[model samples]
Target: MKAEHQNLYQPHKGGTLCKMLFPVLLLTLFFPLGHAQSSMSPEFSIIKPRHSRLLKSALQRETSAFLLSDPWAPLENQGWRSCVESRNGPALPEKSEGYIQVFLDGGLNQQRMGICDAVAVAKILNATLVIPYLEVNPVWKDSSSFEDIYDVDHFIDVLKDDVSIVKELPEEYSWSTREYYATAIRDNRIKVAPVHASANWYLENVLPVLRSYGVAAISPFSHRLSFDNLPMDIQRLRCKVNFQALTFVPHIRTLGDALISRLRYPQDPLKVTAAGDKEMAGKFVVLHLRFDKDMAAHSACDFGGGKAEKLALAKYRQVIWQGRVLNSQFTDEELRSLGRCPMTPEEVGLLLAALGFDNSTRLYLASHKVYGGEARISTLRELFPLMEDKKNLASSEERSQIKGKASLLAAVDYYVGMHSDIFISASPGNMHNAMVGHRTYLNLKTIKPSMALMGQLFLNKNISWSDFQQSVVEGHQNRQGQIRLRKPKQSIYTYPAPDCMCQA
Candidate 1:
């Protein structure tokens, strides 16, 4: 195993050891080796043999007698409440302008945002919306449509007053399909809709098409709508779509409920109990561990996986993105300082430890296959032995419905995440963004980690565990479930304040 590990790190023929050492030496010149690892507490040290130098140095730190506080304590919501004021919005037009179709791309969350935008766009155009087409995710290869994941009847029924949504196109427009638009760019197909496009842009571009053909189909409709400058009603409608209209199919919800039940009451493994059974139930924290291989490679940050991991990620980047990753230009230390790097499983585990979460904490690992697999998450598992995920909590037969389907699996996680007593993401991504906004609307406790502070703290070799804990607590004081009003051009989906919330 040692020989294999060494062989994995060996460079091509004629490459000297100095070549590999040069980058490390260069990094040390700016940021010394002393700043790399000593910052972590000894209690959270990883036990892996071939770990990062940062974890290796953690083993050398003096043990501190720090006790876990009641980390499961509920947080107070400052005077704001979720009040989506759509009552004052303009009433939907009795007569529709035409049919509006959107072919949404990306993962479940991205498509979810698109669905909200499509509804908003339909209202903007006074057009009837055909159920938005969910493009097969290229990465997950999931061909699940909108109906497959969401309760379509509920979706239409909830949004009936806000916008007109249909199950499919009219028979007259049956010829208007995804393939029809792909074969040749018809004038009716608005394919060039820019990212975060203003309402006026859609009126100028799409209204004419609706007038001409009685229908318009927008392909690649992910993030094509603007987050700002829209009417208040439009913004509120978007929120309604996200928070109320979009609900998982019955099976996904059932699975999610089952997982939540198991998390709250772990003693009865064979028998899933009701969520209301509080006698033996415990609160669980949903940790959306977003550290996947694609995210790791795209971030272009070193994760202490050594040279072999680096080489493998580089190859992956080349194959997938043609080496066009922008973060590749910066050093790992620079990225960490800027908070551009994704927190590793070990680092996030340490964060949980520093924030008072201990071995007794019930942690739900909400993620797909983590970048390095089980070996990568072994340290985290060691930290929280009672951790659970979909596979572990649900039987293989229970998981069969969502098996091999990324969107359905993600929907399950999303459902479970929404019901978690507390939610914290290892790093920010689509799922994190969705959960943050949804939890905020419901005024639930959601911890948004201060990445820059965490990076700086982690980089400090001399900082003790107590100091680290204080800094973390102080830095995150204002970040927990606080209603941050949406700034100009900021995502309403992520920050649902002022638009989706009303002062109490």
Candidate 2:
């Protein structure tokens, strides 16, 4: 067996298993028992988490048999098709109003969300958006401009009806830039927002000021525009900006698209016909493996690692994550129970195995180099021997195109994941959120593990592979492609689901 990943298991995540024992349906239709795991397969012996009340009703949640009703369910009232068709609105006048200047920078996900907010704000304020400035992180200080990574002309053309966009300020303002400019808030050199500003907030608070001053210079300029009770038009416009307007630079897009085609239609007929390899023919899963040093530390999951690994990750966290370790109120144990940590690669391997994916199942891992390198991924490699990443899959010439280009490389990951048949995220980070919204926007399925159930089932030493597969398939039948709804309304800004996502 692989090194024990005991740390990945929390202190019984689900509430107390209901005292009244109930029998579960033993058979699963989709995955037959005869086709299940061989008895010779790896058997993991785990020290089961002591049952806590949080994981109650585990044995009897589903009282009766149920079949999958719809493979693709939708969010009601999002009306994306209607909204995109009805996008004609009064934009800012050509010669009259001031400008809404936004600076977009960060890793790919942050910048992607920023672009949406900037476009939505421009629509709200009825001000022309000066070509939003794009900044690269100093970590990977590639001197790539916005146009270098994205098709600037395509952006302007796609959003022509939504708002007037310009690469730079007009000649008049270029000469007297400081004189014509006004910042988002009263402070000349500062930006202010007490909360994730609402579209109405922009319309009411910022628009009048833009009209008065003819230019609003917003710094850190884009993020967290609201989605809740705001006008439907604003929500729809956000979707358009995210899915339609922003596109990768031509060459990078071409590479990603070519990769997509290959995955969708592998040339080898044997790959299509082979028992385990049939899953590779099209729609391979993209595992956004987030086991990087920074992510693990921020999650406070002190999973197996030596003192050097711990210290290295801790120190790295202090430098990158807001210049300090995230001082969460919860303890590491508590965090694990809450599913706050990324699943260990071993845990993920077991998960896919339980889901019936085998060694030959094609899995494109969209990630940075796995932390702890090959040793850490050893267990996962045993389960998924054919897993591929950019390093393994790309040709030397293709690798050169994305080498040293972090943003463009991230774009490639995004496109590949976006087109995959299933996208399984290690954690719900920016990559997951961004891709989930886009995939949801396109009415596609994304399989998110129900950790609550997994935490319970994995504990039972007597649980067979067939029973586990039955539980997972039945549990998640409707979960895939389900219209995501915001639970607590405040989370919409960060999550932007159902709001940023719409059913056509």
Candidate 3:
């Protein structure tokens, strides 16, 4: 009975040899099946791009051991220091040296403007510029890494000999996460460079690339992160070569140029105009409490405080009304309750009425309805409690001019171009600020900074609305001499605007 169970292999062969041979045959037959069924995890398998040679060393047996065991281990290269050493001087004879590129990763949609200020700075420095779009692919089920989004070889090919690409990781602690994308870039398989996250990352990744290539300094923006505090490196680099920081402002250049072009051609309904002395109908000051619903996530760089709703009435008052304010949740009554001096709707109404063009002045309250900004209609009611009675202020007909977010922002480029005054912007990150500032600068009009600090903390040292007001007046006066007063460096005027269609 036991003999009947085995049969085939043990029936007539050498027992030990048959056992070994059978096991080998079974393994051979099932090996492909096991491999076919196996799958990589979502994070790694998804978004897998075509093979990259650079990626070889990153995942190879020995290098991967180092990566897993000691990601921070120093490589045998001079690091970013060499590249920094190369950029010092007067424009590098335009063609004498290679190109350096600073890549802004995860730059999707309107957020691409963050790189605007930086890109404008780049053109001034003569660096070859490239912006790889990291768009997510819907068809691919797996998570797409940065490698899948951008063509690395194509990116490198565009660069001049000595230059390298530096990825600007989004801020730490802020919810805007771009670390995964940056990691993919660093994980180029071949271990040719160091992978990094910040200036320190640059020292690890960029420095190694340059050192290996025997080049010096990458053309980057202000080296404050790398050498500003460390005088020794700066001094050492200073002696070696022109280790200077170059500003790239292409983003700014394009936006500014687009605004200027539209102004130059009025027939284009899609274009924006410069701020004019005459206010347009519904010329309201639009402030953002929350940029869409994700306000809590992306801290307000323009709102002054980290959170928008918590901004004190005092801080709110600091934003002088250049035009009619569609009502914010921060009403005059609320301001008074908070022990902050309040500006009445009558006062706001009076300012609008007194305006050289009241009927033409349109106020807009733009924010997601969920964020709790008073509706434009109700806001108008508060601004003119007696809209039902003209004796108190402007006639009801006059107050009906304000618009809401959808309508207002749709034609923001227009209002900003034709009628807006120094649009008291909330922050640079907002779509409003990008369009308004870009358009304002294109017309060569004086575009001033927001009264609100870059973040709430930016107001800490400069607290007290009184002091803040004084600073606003004083700062503008100072900048007038710089950004506004100068002969307008044509260099500063050439940033590109975002495709207006995207704004649509």
Q: Top model by TM-score, which number?
A: 1
Candidate 2 lDDT over residue span 214-264, tens digit each: 666666665557656766667767767777888888888778866766655
Using lDDT as the measure, name the better of candidate 1 and candidate 2: 1
Judged by whole-model lDDT over C-alpha atoms, candidate 2 comes out at: 0.62
How many pairs of residues in model 1 come into backbone collision? Answer: 0
Cα deviation at 334, candidate 2, in Å, is 3.1
Error of 1 at 239 (Å): 0.7
Tell me the tens digit of each residue's lDDT in model 3 across 396-440.
443232222132222233333333332322323334433443433
Candidate 3's TM-score reads 0.32
- Predicted candidate 1 versus true structure: per-residue lDDT over 241-316, tens digit per residue: 9998998899898888888878887877445455555656788999988988778878998877666667656755
Q: Compare the candidates by lDDT and give the number of the best one.
A: 1
lDDT of each: 0.81, 0.62, 0.29
